[model samples]
Target: MAESTQQKLVCSRAKAKSDTGSSVTQSSSAPKRKASTALPLDMKVRCVSSIPVGPLVYTSRRMQGMIIEWDEFGSEQYIELAELQSMRNSSPAFFENNWILIDDEEVLHFLHADKYYGSAKSIDDLYGILKKHPNHIAQLVKTLPDHLKKTLSIVAYREYTAGRIDSIGVIKAVERATGLSILSN
Candidate 1:
């Protein structure tokens, strides 16, 4: 929107008597008093390092995961506590005596399963593998076969539509099917 160049002036007093018995008036363009504001107003805050403690939420937006841990200086750290604990239990050698300090960007990448999930480049690549699996139906069928590939496809479609599936979900599905942790390849 374009702004207007003209401004209206506001006068505090209509007229004032001068010492010489002459009337004077002061015209001001700016307001004489400060504007009043509502107290205890609700506002939306965008915080990088702070998030409410709860279950991780999955979304299709660029921020695929919505779980952040904050530090003293308001610095953000993304840590999937549940996943980390499970991973520690499964692979004690990897977690034992480890400080658990990881970069926020890396945590986001790990959440999306984009950087370190097996030999695949992305979740889509894993989907492609499932698509070309030997057991996959080449043509539409009234009843899909009870195969791993078919189940994966169904789960993928359902989760994608529900805004739950992303690169991370895809890798996690693969891990669940094969009993492996996929935070890192």
Candidate 2:
């Protein structure tokens, strides 16, 4: 009786194994998943500023140079934009195309080839350029530094409460709050 019971157990085990194998085979033969047409999240910024405020390389209607040292503790990067106005008096000629160079190396380029220029025409122009790349927006939203992320969340919450929680609004809010313009047309 014990022998008969052992054989029955072995037969059941074999049957179970066969059932599992068939299921595995069926799953393997199932339709494969299709790749998404959406842009990837790893898209790089047209321009990138260093953490804790290192060097700033930029091109503006007023100023164009590499600022290696500044009052990082007191002033943020956008203050550099004001420098453009002061320096613009000296540089009267408009640079139709230019590059943000650092350490004598080109970092970012600005060109005005047509109506949709390579450089931003204004704040609205910069905003418009950013609207084209959804992936870039996702990257910024996902990988913003912790402090900035908290601030972004707050901005998003405020916007949500105000019924203005939109892509452009969120981007503009972050830009206004952070004073970091990492994207260009």
Q: RMSD of candidate 2 to the true fold?
A: 18.5
lDDT of 2 by residue, 1-185 (tens): 99999999999999999999999998887685443233322322132122223443334444345443333311223323234333233342222221121111111111111221233322233333344454455444443334433334443444445655456555554555445542333
Report model 2's TM-score to 2 decimal places. Answer: 0.21
Displacement of the residue 149 alpha carbon in candidate 1, Å? 9.8
lDDT, model 2, position 38: 39
The lDDT leader among the candidates is 2
lDDT of 1 by residue, 60-115 (tens): 12234643344422233333344443434444332222112233333324333222
149 Cα displacement, candidate 2 (Å):
0.6
**Candidate 2, after superposition: displacement of residue 77 in Å?**
10
lDDT of each model, Cα atoms only? Answer: 0.34, 0.38
In model 2, state the lDDT of residue 56: 36
What does candidate 1 score on TM?
Answer: 0.19
Worst 10 residues of 2 by lDDT: 101-110
